[model samples]
Target: MTQYQPIAAAAAATEWWRGAVIYQIYPRSFADSNGDGIGDLPGITARLDHVASLGVDAIWLSPFFTSPMKDFGYDIADYCDVDPIFGTLTDFDRLLDRAHALGLKVIIDQVYSHTSDRHAWFQESRSSRGNAKADWYVWADPKPDGSPPSNWQSVFHGPSWTWDGRRGQYYLHNFLPSQPDLNIHNPDVQEAILDTARFWLDRGVDGFRLDAINFSMHDPSLRDNPPVAPGAGPRRRPFDYQHHYYNQSHPDIPTFLARIRRLLDSHGGRFTVAEVGGEQADREMKLFTEGFDRLNSAYGFNFLYADALSPELVRHTIDLWPGAPGEGWPSWAFSNHDAPRHVSRWAAPAERKACAALSMLLLMALRGNVFLYQGEELGLPQADVPFELLQDPEAIANWPNTHGRDGARTPIPWAADAPHAGFSPARPWLPVDPEHVPLAVDRQEEDPDSTLNLTRRLVALRRREEALRCGIIRPLDLAAPLLAFERGDGPDRLLCLFNLGRAPADWRLPEGWTVIEAVGGEATGGSVPPLAGLIARRSA
Candidate 1:
């Protein structure tokens, strides 16, 4: 008998992301197969079993395309080819082949918003005014005073345009100057991006995790964004002090998304998930994933870049879309390549590991697709990377304010005692923290109650429970500082309670509720006289 029994069951499968968890592996830090101190495709291939064992539905590999490593592989020189630093096309095929064999769906990052200045298309576009690809990228003429097209600001700081003397025009770059934004308004440009998607689809990729999809289409008129008054907290950067009306979140983006969705639909059930960020993410996430005709799902930076993790905050995030209709789904990720590790950001040393483990349980209990970063299961805290060893351009450019992304991009420690923590025999690209040495996979593998075990069990538990997967969420009114909710599938209901405070809190349930998974403390009946936090299953 096959694991998938019927064709129709597979075709109409709610298993697309039904309580499914995705593991995000930053390629450069995952594993170094050739010991060049940098990770390669083969390195990831060598570790598919580790990922499969974690009970995740899929694995999302970050950018490995050819580039100058200016913004680490986010600046793509070639969209269809793998970078030499990460091995060859053959290596990626082998990795994908192996991952599929282990029952893991492979999803690769698609950076369609921008391309590196060194890309052939951009090179040709900049060469002349009447070139075949002159309109392939966002090229604009200078204003009356010779300033950029608009006052748009780059995410990396300073202005969003850089002068290109060759073309006698300014290029719009939402990120670094080298990362010129693509012209999505042009039909040929959209076709080229779709063709790039097809290249990977032809290689048997399960789906695509679109990087900054909202950034693909910008305001064609180049309208200036109005200044925003400082709201709650002190404004960190000038970029945050604007409504960002012009630079991104254009009305025409949904049409482009529908076009992309049509292409993916041609491949028979291939999924598309977008990464929506910036000030308007809350609004854009809904717009980008409004209908099934557009993106299958979209995740925002709501919880990822947060400094504090409270029950109320988590509840508010889930309540953002009470009952999302049509094809739009929400994917939640607490940690990723960007931002500091959640362990260090949310908790202290003594309780950080336990709190991190509990977070996994909470994430699994949530009513959305969950994305787990590679080292998150092992409770890996953000490591320290000195300025001398930092390879991240963002960190180097905005050193004092941003703190760079290198610390979170360090090598994944497979063995505590191995040379370079079993990531590489030679010195890794980003140094692994000495404190992270003991928290390696090998050490946690044998321990049943370790964070690794908790991740595996929680994922498995979520998979088994129907109410926990594709059910409707009902927020329960519990005491203060405690987040409680009920996930119900008709007759079955699961009551989830989380004590956000440090002290023990009593959980008063209305009726019959059985404690299923307890995080820290105990629970009894529908009410626990002294309940810390727990996940309880109930029947109507």
Candidate 2:
């Protein structure tokens, strides 16, 4: 085992997350300590050493809350306890202790947008119209014709409103019918959510990744969403047919965020990042993180759900947040539990390795906090999950048309030779991608040129260079297939360039710049090799 020192111990206690690299761990697929074939908190604790070895500042865990697993763990049955599938609260404490001991911060997902229909609050809310919790969820009487309140559509398809016979009214569910949207507009509901945050903070969690936070508060009027503009592309599901204005991104969400921030401030050094995605994500992300009173950071689907990683796309997204006064900080992620792997999405068969390396270099060079998905360091491609074994609700509901998210949520391959790729003692929950076996961690640890090792080096470089951390990004005017930028902070300055194209491209270096680090390909003779990335600094 490699000896590790906690990086947080040496850094400023507050704002440590600024420009930090956070590794996202999907607990259910990361590791399974018990032979039950499902990952538990103890499994995560046992793997803290591997996470620490990557030199990440913190780990953002997907939800492990008590749930009925309808939308996996997103449909929370209880706010304060871990599901039996993920172990008890004691198991979570152990994971936290082990993480902090290794110098890694632990940030868990806080899904305040909705809860499992099985949740006590929802149960009580649906029991009777006059019940104490009746208003805790978004429930409304049907329109005069007994149809849904508006043209709102659920993310999983069909109407967002589900008629509940128990309450003689319709209940709102932005996702699956079983995952009812919480009425955060209700003060009592807000208080209950804040108390849940207090529970985790009191247990020593470093911060929270607010899941689908923009959906926390909906338009109280229940107005219909306007139809999308013509040529908006084919609508795969009913959810994509409208502008989604009245259904989400309500104007009052920031006020609720301020409350969450106030609660976090009381805990000291606690961080909060909101997950904001939609057609109006850029606008809402800014609103949610506009000032110190709101979230610390926000990330959208600019790159995560993108089909291509183009230079123009990179420039456009980075331009959204320039670290200006009153603008909240931004975070960037190329892949996550909910999206397809970038390696498979962006790279051709021959260029997967190069593209993976280039992606990491670009992620670190960008002017914001960065997130690395669990198996991304290993260059894992999207798994091929057949229809019969598919588990995602949205995917199953819109089969054949939607690729689904299960391909990206497969278990991490720990050993190339071990059964189930060393993710569990028995068969894993999701089948391992056969292609990922060769890219397993045990195999890559010995290969100097492997993506795993390269990722570690890039992470370390980001930590060592102040210019790459909290620096201003100045994008250079370049042609398609090539993205160039300069990051500068104080006396430190660095030039970063990437050849996003498959064929080699060349560019003359400006005066005083010399290559400091080159990987995946070369930056020799003022030329960039295919899928190459180079970082340069002014010559002394």
Candidate 3:
């Protein structure tokens, strides 16, 4: 049976994404239904209560479309159907129905940048250059010297071009060769991608999370990308050595985004957020969401996948866009499917559990919408994936140099004693970290001071504070290790302070300061001078 719902004009007028907190659940590991050792739609449906209890405005589900699971589900085999591993389209419909019933908006992933080599479109396109779908993907002839068309490099490693023996041509791939980049330059391709979005919109999806959107456009001349000066930063792949100018972030991307925006507009206020990064994240994020005619918002690697969390780093990323420059606002995520859990990444295991909760508080304290990764509220650490069990290509290719995303994608721990920690009765696709068992949902549900409770309280608090909801950020000229700022909306103001170090620091506020909110590593004490954090609202 099909369950249907419609968005009212009144609700649509307000735009659900502004200051909305989205909880991201990676289906492959969220929970397992039927004990299949793999998570599916039914598993996520069973966990809806948990997601709703967090008071999130919506849920952002990572890809679960029909695929070979090459890049998990980013490689789509079918545009409209659900992968058998996750369940059928009916199950997806039911999940959306239930999510809506709980007042949670449903936002799903749309990987428009590429398609699986096995897709029907790719199959027909690769069959012959004169075929109806010939220009659907970015295909080019080998150079006169019999080499690839350009020096662009794939994220997995080596060249971005893959030799197609059947067509005797080279195909462009920004990530995996199995995932060929689509030719957004083609009008036909644009219509086809729009149709994909229309399929979900017709099915009542509230929005889309556009994967690698900036990569949708490529240089038409097939020029070699210039190499970037080498020094060590977060990017380990040699792909980072180049500036990535010709390969991606072309001027034509904004034009394509407008087309996408128009499709989303037909649904009236549907939210679309792009995942953009590399050399031009700041510029591209701004461009991609320059106006209401483009995407609703965009998130970058500014915090997610970062190896550090210094005060200066946090201030710099926020300073890029105060939301005054662009019509589209920004979204922030500290952890997601791609990055290691912030707890394990930012703090030592001994104090990570407490520090993790504090980080969530800090994330909610920021000026933009928040994206909370599934299991993050439980303070789960990264699973230790053995070499033989690795699934991420980048993780496998780089080995010891990188901690493959496999660790973070492990099944969600739902019970302390159940088999595979209640994620599944059978063996899971990825091993549940033994350390995560203690932090299972059931275990933390009863603890009032648990990270789960802290998240619930913080999210609820954020929902109530207008100043923190859509306020402008005012940076206080504070010292390092003591991060201080204010979120103000006219007369209402919130003074936020965080001790980024292990030891406490003091700050003498200007005269007439009154404490409103107190924050700390483990407690929120409002005492003056030595008490770590202070949130003072001006007394009118």
Superior by TM-score: candidate 2 or candidate 3: 2
Candidate 1's C-alpha runs over 4 A off are: 1-15, 231-234, 508-511, 524-532
RMSD of each: 4.3, 4.7, 5.4
Compared with the true structure, what per-residue lDDT tens digits does model 3 show for residues 158-178? 899999988999999999989
Best by lDDT: 2
TM-scores of the models, in the order given: 0.94, 0.97, 0.94
Worst 10 residues of 3 by lDDT: 1-10
- What's the CA error at residue 149 for candidate 3, in Å? 0.9
**Tens-digit lDDT track of model 2 for 69-100:** 99899999999999999999999998999999
Order the numbered candidates by TM-score, best leading: 2, 1, 3
Assess candidate 1 and give its TM-score to the true structure.
0.94
- Runs with alpha carbons beyond 4 Å of true place in candidate 2: 1-13
Identify the leading candidate in terms of TM-score. 2
Quote the positional error of residue 231 for candidate 3 in Å: 2.7
With candidate 2 superimposed using the best TM-score fit, by how many Å does residue 161's alpha carbon deviate from the native?
0.9
Quantify all predictions' global Cα lDDT against the true fold. 0.83, 0.89, 0.84
